[model samples]
Target: MLTLSIFAVLLLMLLIDIPIAVAIGLTAVVFFVAQGQSSFLAMLPQRMYSGTTGFTLLAIPFFILAGNLMNCGGTTQRLFRFARALVGHVPGGVGQVSVVSSMIFSGMSGSAVADAAGLGQIQHRAMVDAGYKPTISAAIVAGASTIGPVIPPSIPFVLYGAITSVSVSRLFLAGAIPGAVMGLAMMLAIWLMAKPRNLPKDPRANLHEIWDSFTAAFLPLMAPVIIIGGITTGFFTPTEASVIASLYALALGFLYRDLTWKEIPAILFTSLKQTCGLMFIIATANFFGWFTIFERIPDALITQLAAFGTTATGFIWIVIAIVLVLGCFIDGNAIFLITLPIFMKLCPLYGVDMVNFGVVMTLLIMIGNLTPPVGMCLFAVESFAKVGIWSLAYECFPYLIAILAVTILCAFVPEIALWLPNYVMGAAG
Candidate 1:
């Protein structure tokens, strides 16, 4: 009943349009005061500070900056050109390009909103020009953007590793195959719709064109290879990889001359704003997470689940259902921060592997960005889409199903997420 009331208040605050960070902080404050535990408020400052102090957490900002720089530095466009060269001639040509391009960009940005807002403009424009419907074009962009975080170099995976003390390198490796699976599934959906919907088909590029496009994107393309290789080879940590990624992106901005020195300030400012918002949420949500642990919420949940003989698979399904429903109403980061403590405890009891769960959880969280009511990717695409949110949401259904299928696959077949990590890291402890 206590947990119910706290969440009820949190949900009410979210419904009323309160900022996620503030809403969480306020809910904790209100409950503490009401319970005559206002003394806990004294630790607020310390807890919030300590929450943002994790070394792994340092990667978040650099990754965000790297993504911002890449977006502004001609990286996204080159990736799109290369993707189009490879698949632009297929049925649902432009749509296929959007998915493939997002997969490539995902390897760098590790952010759905970045992909949606940055690559999305190019994709939506290209699709519209190629004769796709405006609504479908927007949906394709929004849906494809979800692929960003599922690939390597993911911000969510970094945060999950920090919060859970899981291996960030393993998490990065774990995402590789599932991300590819998502791209392929989305492409298949587009292909199935091609004939009936009369999706456009562009002329295939010759070998020379493909070679030239790849060469154009070669440097930017190296971002992921450098990141994954450096980590797997024990050369650098994920946080260091983020710094290298940012530096590389900055170099590309100048080398290609796509981003001028004057643009650097604006790019840094944009990355700063995003990083600050995310950090604030982390700060407050950390306090809220502590409150849940203090109240023994995980203990209570474990008791209830045990009473029902819940299995690992059953636990995953429950989490998926909750995440998908709450995803419509809450930001993915908030949901992650608030529920992580409770979920982490259940992992061992249910025999679920943390590394595998990390990938699956990250995939589910990104799916939230494609959902309506507060879907960040939907709004990002809608900014240029000019289509009603509902219409865009409607069109995203097929791609959503495709992603959810991959998520379910990961949850059930742990090997899907764990195989690569185990192969490279010699199995996670």
Candidate 2:
């Protein structure tokens, strides 16, 4: 009764528009109060501190800073030209460019919010300028932006690695194929819908134009290659890769003369603000996680599922459904931090492959970023496009289904998630 009550309070607060960090923190507080003890409340500070103290968690802010710097350094303009040069002749050319640009940006940012906010601004505006409906323009960008987390160098993957002791490198390799699948799928979906509408296309770029755009975009393009290559070849860890990314972006900012010394402090301040909010979520969610383990909540859940004779596959499907639904109302990382402890513990019993589980799990929760009512990506795109969330959600629905279908296929076919990692890492377990 007490456990259920805590969840009830949590869900109620989420539905009532409480900030996520507050909702999670309040839920833990409610749990303590309902437990009939102020003593349980005392554990909150320690748990919160421990949650954010890990060195691996440090990668989050560095990556965010790197992304912001690149965005501000005019990386988007170059990437856009390159994307348009390659795909602007395709059906729904502007929409196709949005999808392609998102895939390219993901390699650099590894953040859906960053992709949506930084690049989506340019992409969506360009789509609207191209005569696409504002809502549809926003929707296309929102759907494609989900790939940010699905791709390598993902912040969520790093968080998962830190929390569960999974190898971050393995997770990165695992995401590559799935991420590529999503990009290609989105483009194909665009083509089918685009040719019918006679969507506007850029005059096909001459070879010289393509070369010029590619050359101008070269350094920003190497951001992903450097991070992935360094990690894959064992030259550095993800944390070091993140630091490298920040420094590389800084270099390019100066090289391009797009960012000046006067702007440095502001960028750092913005990065700090974003990092603090994220850390607050991590801290508070850890308190909630602590209470969850103290109450043996995962055990309770597994036992109940067993009573219903839930098989391993059934368990995976059920988890996917629950996460998908919860995703509609909450943030993705918050969901991961809250629910992963329970799911990780259950995986062993169900014979779930941890690498595959972690990869598919990231992809599934990320879809929520594109969903309605509270999708972070949806709202981000909506703000700039000046469109309604429902309208954007409606337009985004097909692309959403396309990505989710790939996600389900990934869940059923573990090789899709594991083969690359295993082949690359030499038998990832």
- Candidate with maximal lDDT: 1
- Pick by TM-score: which candidate is best? 1
**lDDT (Cα, tens digit) per residue for candidate 1, span 172-252:** 999999999999999999999999999997998999999999999998888899989999999999999999989999999
C-alpha-based local distance difference test score of model 2: 0.88
RMSD of 2: 1.3
| The 10-residue segment with the lowest total lDDT in model 2 | 1-10
Model 2 clash pairs? Answer: none
Give the lowest summed-lDDT range of ten residues in model 1.
Answer: 420-429
lDDT of 1 at 163: 92
